[model samples]
Target: LSTVHIESDNANNTLIAIGGDNVYLTFTPEEPLLLDSIVVTIAGLATTLTESNGSYTATLTLTGSEPDGILEFTIDFKDRAGNPGIQVTATTDESYVNHDIYPPEIEIISITSNNSDSTWAKVGDSVFVTFTASETLDNISITIAGVSSSYNELSVAKYQGYHVMDDSNDEGDIPFLITYTDLGGAIGPDADTTTNNTNVQFDKTVPEFSLTRMATNNVYGDSLAGIGSVDTLSFTISENQRDLNVELAGSQKTPEQEELNFITTHTFSESD
Candidate 1:
């Protein structure tokens, strides 16, 4: 007699988390032959099987609070001819992990700051990034603008990180890659990908504004220093400023008073 196939539903060939349950073992013979009995050994427990219908089926139940380790299954059968067939055995590759495997779930919610919601941060400004995970991850990292940085766990399932933009960070949508591993060592599909996918923005320079107090300054060209009839005041802005308005103390100035036919506010816009 020759053994055809042997397996346990819980066995994944490498690791099996039986968790002290009844593992149904099935053994098929290469050809139909009279089988008197079958002895099966799982781990250290042994049992005899008598159920057969062209094959043999046995239920092996494990118990106790034993630590997870290597699992080996050995089967020995006797033919009706009172002859013993070849012994068949199957063991896990290394050790059996008898614990539930729950892959980690990670997501990047938002990367923004209190000053701006457009995901824009100036140099030396900390960009706060919010993250959520289903479970406590074993490893968590963030890759922004081609640079990778580790993260610190804050609470149970919430995590955040601060990424400071420097002169190296140009004006563009910075790609953010979050890689994480769960307690079971399971990672996402595109975990290590460095493509420009998820992203934030970085502004290297702060907006610069210059005021040219242009008024009827006599021949000396020293315009009225204080609150003079500020008629036709020339303004110069280094960069573009959005929602910009010229305010005096608390009141916002109208376009007529803030601008003239020759000069206006200098505004610039940049996108990544």
Candidate 2:
């Protein structure tokens, strides 16, 4: 070998480069030195050398499909003086220094009913809910209660649909669940919650009621004189509870009065 100037030897120097190139080694002995071999083993590839020059250099090209990490290899040499020595097996890291992290993710913060068109058919046609992450999401699997659904879309915000999970229309906000996973298999740190773009949410609360007379709904039998009604009823319901039936005690209210009794039954919900 010419000279073992690899700092670890009689010399100390740092030599590093990208791609394929030659690595230098220096040596000097009393007689002409004949070299042996330089071997390289990368994560996914291998190369070798059989002969050498007394004071020459060897080149190795690191390329293709190699895993991202350090690659180790060895260089062995023998001189005419029967001096046998091997360079410490060396390694270099394969790094994607510029690998990009995705943008902030629109975690299924929440989805909700804007109106009649609300959540998913499986999820009690109500509100959709989800969250947003500070990082991007390459893929995410969303399940409700226990049912799994695939949700792999990119957005700064998301409107997740509620999956009813079963055939039960029992009105309650129902159990809400969400999981956001990134491509690297990292989960966000935030305790996920929902937000409302329209600031409107589905209401699921213990409803209240009140009563007042819609009118002095006088009942008069076709008589010579108009008769006065004794029963006066008053009641109140939520505007959301529309199309619900309201009735008075033991009075067959008809037509117009009956229609007012049927009020809508919708709850109000809020999230941010």
Question: lDDT tens string, model 1, 1-272?
Answer: 33333333443321344344445556676655455456776665775465556767656665634334444567776666757777777522222334333456764356665446445667776665667777676567776666665566788877776667778766777656677765545564334322224346676766666675545433445443333323344566666555657654233454433332224222212310
Clashing pairs in 1: 240-267, 240-268
**Local error of candidate 2 at residue 36 (angstroms):** 11
lDDT of 2 by residue, 1-272 (tens): 22333211101112322233223322333355454433333332444333344343333343323333233334555556667655534423322111112323553355555356354232344343455666555345565444554443346544344443344433444344555544334344433345453222334343566564443333453211223333344455434443445444333443233422432211112310
Collision count for each candidate, in order: 2, 48
RMSD of 1: 12.8
Which ranges of candidate 1 are over 4 A from the true structure? 1-96, 99-102, 114-118, 191-200, 209-213, 217-230, 242-272
Q: Best candidate per TM-score, number?
A: 1
- Which model scores highest in lDDT? 1
How do all models score by TM-score?
0.48, 0.36
Candidate RMSDs in order:
12.8, 14.6
